[model samples]
Target: MANIKKGDLVQVISGPTQARGGDRGKQGKVIEVLKAEDRVVVEGVNFVTKHVRVGQTQRGTKTGGIETHEAPIHVSNVQLVDPKSKKPTRVGFREDKVTKDGVTKTVRVRYAKKSGEDL
Candidate 1:
């Protein structure tokens, strides 16, 4: 079960920035999910630098030199931001009852543990 998903707002609880406490308590939207690596790319978080050669590219002229971008952070190091409280909150699944075509069924829905609000 993936507790965290793309476009989720998350706060960094711990990671490489722990040394400087830079990324701690920082919140950002999840840009991508790497299920296999158990990591996630958060916007404006976990930045990394890479050197590249300037050249022409499909998008446009490549002016490459020490390019920086967000790197993947471990999912365990971040927590979902609560919509109501706007703080980090644990996620839980709840079964909601619904009727369709004269049939009643229950579906799992994600909710915030702190405020018990739908996520």
Candidate 2:
């Protein structure tokens, strides 16, 4: 598996209008992961539009708007943003040596290179 997983915080690293200084380093949380295409849908990020059937569909949640957000960005294009400093950071995966279980299991852990702190 890739180093990225759902519920992880990430940053807009490379993309149109995001490659430059403005939104390049803007932080967001990883909401979904499309592993087949190596894509990730960040929360409140990479917004797009979609048509919704008003009141015709109910998924046990509130319903609104005919056009909705729909955008799935490439996983490689985004970098994991550090939660503490709120800056873009690199993520690395290794066996969790200090896990409660005696068995070995790999975990997608991150460490801020600039701050030198484990995320």
Candidate 3:
């Protein structure tokens, strides 16, 4: 299982500090997870500009130009935020027991190691 998932809050644990105009310590929700590349695109982080060829849509609407958007960052550079503490922390998994309709089942749950709270 991945430590970080789409829609999970995360903070950039690496990179230069804000004073240096870097994304270190910035917190944002995970917009997408690039599992194949081991990178994640966090909302409002790692902004990059892309230039594209100008074109027109089938409806005659102009499209393509310089656009800014969040770029994928290495997964190791981010850590999951602890809900209770509201701080970045390591994630851990534990077995959870659930009983429904007299059927007991074990499930793995993600939790914040720092606050010992389930995420």
Candidate 4:
């Protein structure tokens, strides 16, 4: 399982975005996780602009113009933010006993290594 998932808030640790200076320590939510490519699209991060043909349109909607959106960043470039500390921390899995409908079993749960709390 991926330590980072969709909707998880993350801090940029290192990457192209970090190299730019301003976004080095910025934190944003994960918009999409590309597991196969081991990359994630964080909200408001790694923005890229695409220019379209002026006369392009799909159906009744305009499809031509400059569009900006978040681009995928390597997973290693981000670190999960600890909910308790509000600081970036590493993620680790732990076994926990969970009971559902009276059936109890051990399940692996992701936790913040710094705070030892379930994520």
Q: Give lDDT per model, in order.
A: 0.88, 0.69, 0.94, 0.86
In model 4, which runs have C-alpha deviations exceeding 4 angstroms? 16-22, 55-61, 115-119
TM-score of each: 0.83, 0.65, 0.92, 0.83
lDDT of 1 by residue, 1-119 (tens): 67999999999987556567578888999999999999999998888898888787888966778889999998999999988889889999989999999999999989879744544
Lowest lDDT sum, 10 consecutive residues, model 1, at 110-119
| Candidate 1: clashing pairs of residues | none
Error of 4 at 68 (Å): 1.0
For model 2, how does the per-residue alpha-carbon lDDT over 21-88 read when each residue is reduced to its tens digit?
A: 24456577787899888898887776667766556445566565767563788887788766677776
**lDDT (Cα, tens digit) per residue for candidate 4, span 1-119:** 77999999899877555555546688999999999999999998888999978674556665678989889999998999998888899989999999999999999999988744544
- Choose 2 or 3, whichever is better by lDDT: 3
Ranking by lDDT: 3, 1, 4, 2
lDDT of each residue in 1-119, candidate 3, tens digit only = 88999999999989999999999999999999999999999999999999999999999999999999999999999999988898888889999999999999999999888744534
Model 2 lDDT, full chain set: 0.69
Measured over all alpha carbons after superposition, the RMSD of each candidate to the real structure, in angstroms, is 3.7, 5.1, 2.8, 3.6
In model 4, what is the error at residue 79, expressed in angstroms? Answer: 0.3
Error of 2 at 63 (Å): 7.6
| C-alpha lDDT of residue 20 in model 2 | 44
Per-residue error for 96 in candidate 2, Å, reads: 4.3
> Higher-TM-score candidate among 2 and 4?
4
